[model samples]
Target: MKLDLTDRQNQVLQCVIDAKQQKKRPYTKGVVSRMQEKGFQITERQCAYDLSVLARTKGTGIIGMRWGGGRTLWIYDEGCIQEGAA
Candidate 1:
């Protein structure tokens, strides 16, 4: 998708991508903490909002699902779907 993300949103997306690449769960809290550790000021609430927006936005290739009895949220790319049918 042609993402029209703000600079901050792009950074948030990068954090999610990094976690996916590392086979780690891209939870809201985790992403926020990772960004903060890297000196990228972000809050858990804001991260959660970003994830929700990204997932709900069309053609973003980002997908978010709730697990752990709907208490846990994980974000990842819908890579295969975005690649289209072979």
Candidate 2:
């Protein structure tokens, strides 16, 4: 399922996907830090909001998230295609 995502949303998602592709540890934090380094001027809260929206629009089984303690984990369907990742 494809959802219409804003440019910034796409950018943030791309960051996540890219990290995953690189087999990087702590990909989630990498996404936030990389995006900030890219000068997106986004807060972690805003980025988390975007991910939540993406998870929703990504369809019921396409994405997932879990929050416990002070950390949140995001999941992506391995088979789902990300349109804007590098």
Candidate 3:
């Protein structure tokens, strides 16, 4: 299904993308926090929701967190990219 993201959601997604690409690392709480400091204003809950949307509709790989852990991480599935590019 096609996901119709709001401008804010797009901004959040771009933030995630930039963070991942810039450091060649997964999405983390620190990354999100830095993005928030840069003016994203998103909460951890919102980030989780956005991640869910990306996983379900956009097919971006899920940002995983260890069970009962503090850090968060993402894996960008190449399939998601190819699908989006198609």
Candidate 4:
């Protein structure tokens, strides 16, 4: 599905998708680290904010599940088409 998001948000979503595809659990820490490794200069707080916005936005297909102790599991819904991806 098509989505309206900033470049960083898009990168965050893509990171989640990559994590899922790689069979690794996509947690906020991992996601932020991955983004940083990709040279995005993202922090955990920024990642969380981007995720919250994406979850609230329509057709983005991002879901965040809190797993106690303030930890969150990020999921990229496979039901929607990933923007800029084939």
Candidate 5:
């Protein structure tokens, strides 16, 4: 499904996907902090909201907090189209 997100939302989701692909846990707060460090200017609450949308939105196939020892992390499901997929 197409996610009707703003450009900044897309960027944050892309970052989460990249981090997961690299075998790093994409925790909401951590990702937000990293993005801010890189000058993205996103807040933790915003990240949480986006992540919740990803998890709850149908056809997005974005998984949340799976098997990470209780840490709030997220990853896109394998069948979901990635941010940059053709």
Candidate 6:
């Protein structure tokens, strides 16, 4: 399904993308910290909120934390999925 992301959600998504690019890692905890380091005035909860949205919406190219169970869990970027699909 197509999904429209808010500005904040997009920012959060971009942050995750950049972080992954630099660290070669994708995960929730790092995303939360990265958001803060980048001066995004949001809490981990808020980050998780956007993540949940990205995860649920098919084709968004993001995979959010499912079950809220692991710090090692990550946000995935699917090169195969384009913005048009999202």
Tens-digit lDDT track of model 5 for 1-86: 66687777677777777777878877888779768877888888988887777677655556776464766777766565555331
Q: For model 5, state the Cα shift of residue 64 in Å.
A: 1.1
Q: Lowest summed-lDDT stretch of 10 residues in model 3?
A: 58-67
Task: List ranges where model 3 is wrong by over 4 Å.
Answer: 1-3, 59-71, 77-79, 84-86
C-alpha lDDT score of every prediction, in listed order: 0.74, 0.64, 0.61, 0.82, 0.73, 0.70
lDDT of 1: 0.74
Q: Give the 10-residue window scoring lowest on summed lDDT in candidate 5.
A: 77-86
Give the alpha carbon lDDT tens digit for every residue of 7-29 in model 6.
Answer: 88888778767866776566666
Per-candidate alpha-carbon RMSD to the true structure:
3.2, 4.9, 3.8, 4.1, 4.4, 3.4
> How does model 2 score by TM-score?
0.69
The residue pairs that clash in candidate 1, if any, are none
Number of backbone-clashing residue pairs for each candidate, in the order shown: 0, 0, 0, 1, 0, 1
Model 1: per-residue lDDT, tens digit, 2-65? 6788887878778877888898976688889888987988878888888777776666566777
- The sequence of per-residue lDDT tens digits that candidate 2 reaches over residues 1-86 is 56578988888777766666776533356568979888888877788777777766643222545556555666555555454321
Residue pairs clashing in model 5 are none
Off by over 4 Å in 4: 80-86
Clashes by residue pair, model 3? none
Ranking by lDDT: 4, 1, 5, 6, 2, 3
Name the top lDDT candidate.
4
Error of 4 at 59 (Å): 1.5
Please give the lDDT score at residue 84 for candidate 6.
Answer: 40
Question: Which lDDT value does model 6 have at 47?
Answer: 77
Predict model 5's lDDT versus the native. 0.73
* Top of the candidates by TM-score: 4
